[model samples]
Target: MRPVNATDRTPADLLRSALATDPARPLVTFYDDATGERVELSVATFANWVAKTANLIQNELAAEPGERVALLLPAHWQTAVWLLACSSAGVVADIAGDPSAADHVVAGPGRFEDGLACSGERIALSLAPLGRRFPQPPAGYADYAVEVPSQGDLFRPYAPVDPEAAALIVAGAELTGAEVVDRSRADAPGLDLTGPGSRLLSGLPYDTWDGLSAGLYAPLAAGGSVVLCRNLDRLGEDALAKRIESERVTATAR
Candidate 1:
């Protein structure tokens, strides 16, 4: 089989390459101090979640290419899965954006009511410690845990995704799928994120380019892994340093 060229690949394609290169390597580690939660995912495991979530978007929600999906959640591992799922399904991920303008909305419990108000279909995620199903699902929304499990483990988009089509809207800028890939490729080396395994610890919000780069794109582009921290402000300096030491974080993005 011919090897795929990196320049020709999308951000989603980079994830597949990461899985192929080292399926057992940790792709993401997440911590939420307020919730006292910690979770880690290997490349293969992360890719599986992405596939299942993509199936939910494609099969159940009937999300078409170029559709907009509003992501109303925090810096959780599942949020990473949703981001990749949107890319794989060719849907634009609107991170913490106005849900009213979306074709579909995925929200955590804190944003569930607002998500329901949107005219589009909704997927509610508990974002519970282990990504558990909601105790009581909202009347009209699909519970991510309940529905995503039965979906196919493999995903193929119903139509070809145009790399030039808008794929992300964040921090008041919109980027096409190809632009995201190009930018990540160009910026990764400069960010000290190049990897055959770099480990990055990031305390950035997902709503901005810097945060997205540190938390998602950079690591994927460089074949590195990320330790994404939420409620980082709540952690004392000593605790933070200990986390870095234990996780073997090679770089810090604040």
Candidate 2:
């Protein structure tokens, strides 16, 4: 339910934009994918979570601005929050995953033929399980942890985000530049997913146009959140319900 307008804003713009005018609305509903239980996150609560998560990424994870980050996560609620927090804090979420192809296959934009490449800045991250003990941070990371209680909304503002600055780093070379905000739209519905308030439940990865845009970007663009479950055990309905119930997500693309 979006009006036709020039949407140059990244998925991050959504929650803040909504918070600017509507902070008390029911912005998220965590539904148990299996049992169908629900927990709604008010606008203020969602904003708080985003700020806290963003702080963890920026301060603890040392996610510098404009850096390309690779998110290797299965479809669930946490993935959505990670994406939105990154967007709000100006961290590029260059999501990567395998579609319905072989385990060795991955998503690609085939832009290497366009004559562009990485500028020697690349990071790969795996959002490990909070269910188990923390795993080692990927290469180049300074420290790592599986979970941290809310960093809270008591953090500082991040560096100014250059709208066109690279907000992503996927298979496409130099994924996105500071001058390419206008072109973030994939010219495909699947690529223009949504922002917070929406729900995208899947046990798959966020690599395909549908998964990335609809699942990650769409909800955030709409001032909503994303939920990425491990999708382990193929994600039964009970697990999905738990995420939705905990997050209080409303709409969903998947």
Candidate 3:
């Protein structure tokens, strides 16, 4: 596996490096025990999602560089996509942030009322199986599932992304794109992610910096993959053990 380079100052850079090394390698494997749903994304597939979503953020939402998008979704696969999309688009992703203060907002079905507070563009994610659209589209909100499919497979930012610009707001601390990458790389060792094929199974939410690092950034920076589990506590101990064995998880972050 190729190590993250000094030129890789942002999360998007890390992703690009991974895609270059092994496009077919699994990057993220998501599980929702409550729904009995599982979705796997390879490096290429995940990059495709990031590209389309970034296009949505730029072309549809009209979000400019440095603008902030309040992310009101849970620790799901789409939320991970949005995080990378925000980076690729040069916008900031505020996890579980106040919608009223954002330039745009992305919310799940349960947060529609809160999403309505954003005066700018609003995107709603159904988070249903197969990333389905809402049966009834919420008024004033663009359905992400419907809009993303038509976006181009490639993405180019309208403006250059400054590594110094704020890229994420997690746990009340703002981090620049460079800083996020730096911290993620620094945390890899602590998480026991020691190079290629290191697999970490994480049940942590995305609300905090720690969770974000464990669930996505650390494994990514270490040239490894992640098994992200939502509603993880609902699974019985025996079931969880079986899952760990089946997924070949090397470590766990709870």
Best by TM-score: 3
Can you tell me which runs of candidate 2 are displaced by over 4 Å? 1-8, 28-40, 97-147, 171-204, 222-254
Instruction: Provide the global lDDT of candidate 2 against the true structure.
Output: 0.49
Q: Tens digits of per-residue lDDT for model 1 on 1-254?
A: 12335544566888878877889999999999898899999999999999999999998999899889999988789999999999999999999878888899999877887887678889999888898887899877888999999988898988877888998999779999888877877767776876666888999999888888889888888888999999999999999999999999989998
Q: Count the backbone clashes (under 3 Å) in each candidate.
A: 0, 54, 0
- RMSD for each of the candidates: 2.4, 8.6, 0.9
Residue 54 in model 1: shift from native, Å? 0.4
Model 3 superposed RMSD (Cα): 0.9
Candidate with best lDDT? 3
* Clashing pairs in model 3, backbone N/Cα/C closer than 3 A: none
Q: Give me candidate 2's TM-score against the actual structure.
A: 0.56
List, residue by residue over 1-254, the lDDT tens digit for candidate 3. 34558889999999999999889989999999889999999999999999999999999999999999999999998899999999999999999999999999999968999889999999989999899988877988989999999999999998889999999999789999999999999999999899898999999999999999999999989999999999999999999999999999999999
The regions of model 1 sitting more than 4 angstroms off are: 1-4
Ranking by TM-score: 3, 1, 2
TM-score of 1: 0.95
Question: Where does candidate 3 stray beyond 4 Å?
Answer: none
Q: Please, what are the lDDT tens digits per residue for candidate 2 over residues 79-130? A: 5566667676676765552222111111112312121123332222233333
